[model samples]
Target chain A: MTDAPAPGRGWVAVVGLGPGDPRYLTPSAAAILAEAEDLIGYFPYVARVPERPGLVRHASDNRVEVERAAHALALAAAGRRVAVVSGGDPGVFAMAAALFEALEAGDPAWRRLTITVEPGITAMLAAAARVGAPLGGDFCAISLSDNLKPWEVVTARLEAVLRAGLVVALYNPISRARPWQLGAALRLAAEHRGSETPVVLARAVGRDDESVRVLPLAEAADAPADMATLVIIGAESTRLIPREGATPYVYTPRSVEAAR
Target chain B: MTDAPAPGRGWVAVVGLGPGDPRYLTPSAAAILAEAEDLIGYFPYVARVPERPGLVRHASDNRVEVERAAHALALAAAGRRVAVVSGGDPGVFAMAAALFEALEAGDPAWRRLTITVEPGITAMLAAAARVGAPLGGDFCAISLSDNLKPWEVVTARLEAVLRAGLVVALYNPISRARPWQLGAALRLAAEHRGSETPVVLARAVGRDDESVRVLPLAEAADAPADMATLVIIGAESTRLIPREGATPYVYTPRSVEAAR
Candidate 1:
């Protein structure tokens, strides 16, 4: 770095840190972070960024995304190089949308500021990799947390996607406030798919303690899960191959029969 | 460097190179590529890896994924440290599924070999980042190609997802053999949603010549697209903001009304 970013010309980059592993962080995001003078995000996500000289960190609570986003924009509007970092791909149920929601409702000047959204390896992709290619075909990702949307809407979308027979990746499967949503979601899935359908439960993927398990849909409602867990409910074509000494391989074939 | 890898003990790692940018390749994937003795993939993807003295490249034509996968498996079974590389994510309509298809149908002994699938920044994610957080809410991905699946199934899945009002990310939208599919998909989406719905077209994201544009669903069917393009059809809540001298930002709000 030669000279510091000048005042009155700040920009904001909403970047993803990629699940929980530094190794999954894109070099593009890393370079941007290296040049950022300020970082803004939720407390734990902000804590993930290493502290350094001349860089300020703004940590806020989880549900206050709009407030935090407005703060980031106000800083950037004053010409501070800023980055709003998220644990996974910011565009996928992360900070990018929140930032945009704030931007559209905030000052029009914020719209003129340079903004970039950087992609990352989201948790579902990381989870799918640890298992086999369970999402090789058509797929959809739905968040089980009804904090933003009504629970009825969540189930409606879930049932619609399930009936379509697309492989589904469920995020925020279970949290403190919502203990039984995953079970309900699983039961709903089993109604449209076969009982022997493969359900991939992946927790903390890309972390040291990552756990990925594939079970039949019949047995998944009672499976353990947490807020960080990502569940992939496979289509009818999804298959599981039991390995002799390792976890089974689950994959959805690229081809489907004409009869379907 | 350490001694050469011994025969009969070599393993295969299916890894993604991300979407055309070296910076998008995760450190985990880079490390794996660095250790690979043999790289197998489509010609374009295989050519992306820089040639070295000890590294062997096995590039083949497109549509030969299964053949290429079997070749990789045979090579790995002979104790060659092989990497089945795919552009974007290997698990998303890429090599990982093909490799598994071959594994299950190939020799029984191949199941014992250790296999690892490394995730990458897929094209849809990269494309979404280049534009805006069009995928901020629930979303689904569908391939337009009918090579493996029938066109009826493609439309059936497309209509199902569109009826659910989730953001739809269309991959392999158009190609030589399937030049008219993207238009068909846009038309199908228009049937389920308003013609004024936002459609984000991102081409070759993360590449030097990347192009991202936001338009209405009415204009997207005629919009220029190719195999490298990814089209995201927004839901009812998707909003677009026009900037003074830049492309419009498109994003779906995180929340849905209770009435929805």
Candidate 2:
């Protein structure tokens, strides 16, 4: 076992909360949260965290200042066990980057604290598992959010995934202002992946009203997808396997031809 | 929660024993084993299963007669709560298919039993997780064992994974008789994946003395791999993302130039 570092230096465990279900929560994650003195996260994710006595909760706006990031580091520096919580796995598209950004500012005090990322079930994995392995084979994940980078960069990556024949897992595919982006993404996908390539829409997976819709890529683009939906575009090899009573799951053949 | 089906008519739960670690067993799976009256599996897998009173263990050789499959099904049909166990995930390259084959030939009386596959932490996921998110995007799991299929079939699948740039998780990559297949697979990968494409060699993942080696795809192919190893090939977008004081973890960019 990897030895735990000496205690009392304020540490942060960036934990993945899993795909929105408490039952899916790993016992290790649960135990960490129960023992944490504080939880810091985006407001919606903070709300999802179960309330426990003696836990100080810090919630911030969707996009906040670097100072907010520093505040988390400061809390941990103050000798409190803190969990910088993220809804899905924290390492993938979550707090790990921002955490480093804060520490990189070269604060002498912050350098002394230990930080670790506890793996959680990523949304892509959870969505793929729910939909029946559409993730089989080369795949790419692209967020439709142009908030962080130029739209040009996003469009370029989309083209790369297509040329590489990589399945695409679209995160932030659609938000209030980004409705047209999803339509545009579909158009790009249609250029390479057949219009009939299976698209899985996993909305609010592992929660009430969980919806897993499987259709061709053409139809999924027109579906009522939102920020909460994770879109998986299967390669030519992925097939819809109909189970007797359960949801239709996608399976990619070990052979690429089997996907067709 | 899905209701537990009654046990009178007989039931088979194809359970994944996980990567040689008892702690990785899911709570639901553990509960089912505790209630099972019989455990039928290949000898090694049967040995891995926990012992309890009232539970009879039946183990068959790897090359056992086909009737052993029928016998297991018939025993379960005789009102025994049976668990057909396999290492890693039972559904992935394991007992689910064999169990189904036996059930297909059994008397109609066996149809009344509910067959449930309790997912275990597959070697692919466990190995991938240990190495950084090599499976962060689209991927496929292909068994290099050509015992059942022709080598040509396996070669074709490797080509597809390469042409499509899918992160490929390899199972049974090398065995005593077919030690050279792993080298052949690597040569194919070198031709397709960039020479620097990350490869993860996870030997006996999740087991004691589990060793994880991260290297370029070319370096990994000739490395001393065995049947116990799970090899993960990175997609074009996969990269080494370094975190503070930790080993570099693999990540595939959500957006690749090919997709955009």
Compute DockQ for each candidate against the true complex: 0.85, 0.15
DockQ, structure candidate 1: 0.85
User: Each model's TM-score?
Assistant: 0.97, 0.71
Per-residue accuracy of model 1 over B1-260 as CA lDDT, tens digit each: 46466667788999999999999999999999999999999988999998888999889999999998899888888888999999999999899999999999998988988889999999889988887799999999998889999998888888888877799999989998888889988998888899899998898887888888888999999989988888899998999988887888888999988753
lDDT of 2 by residue, A1-260 (tens): 22232346578776667677765455556777877778888887788887776788998876663556688788777777888887766645666555655665647667667666555556776676554445544355566777665677666666655654556778878888777888888888888888888888889876787888888887877899888888887766666655566665565543333222
For model 2, residues B10-68, the per-residue Cα lDDT tens digits are: 77787767777775555556777887778887888888877876779898877452355
TM-score evaluated only on chain B, model 2: 0.91
- State interface RMSD in Å for all models: 1.0, 6.0
Question: Once model 1 is optimally superposed onto the true structure by TM-score, how far is the C-alpha of residue B166 displaced, in angstroms?
Answer: 0.4
Instruction: Give the TM-score between model 1's chain B and the true chain B.
Output: 0.97
Task: Give the worst 10-residue stretch by lDDT in candidate 1 chain B.
Answer: B1-10
lDDT of 1 by residue, A168-230 (tens): 999989988899999999999989999999999999987778888889999999999998899
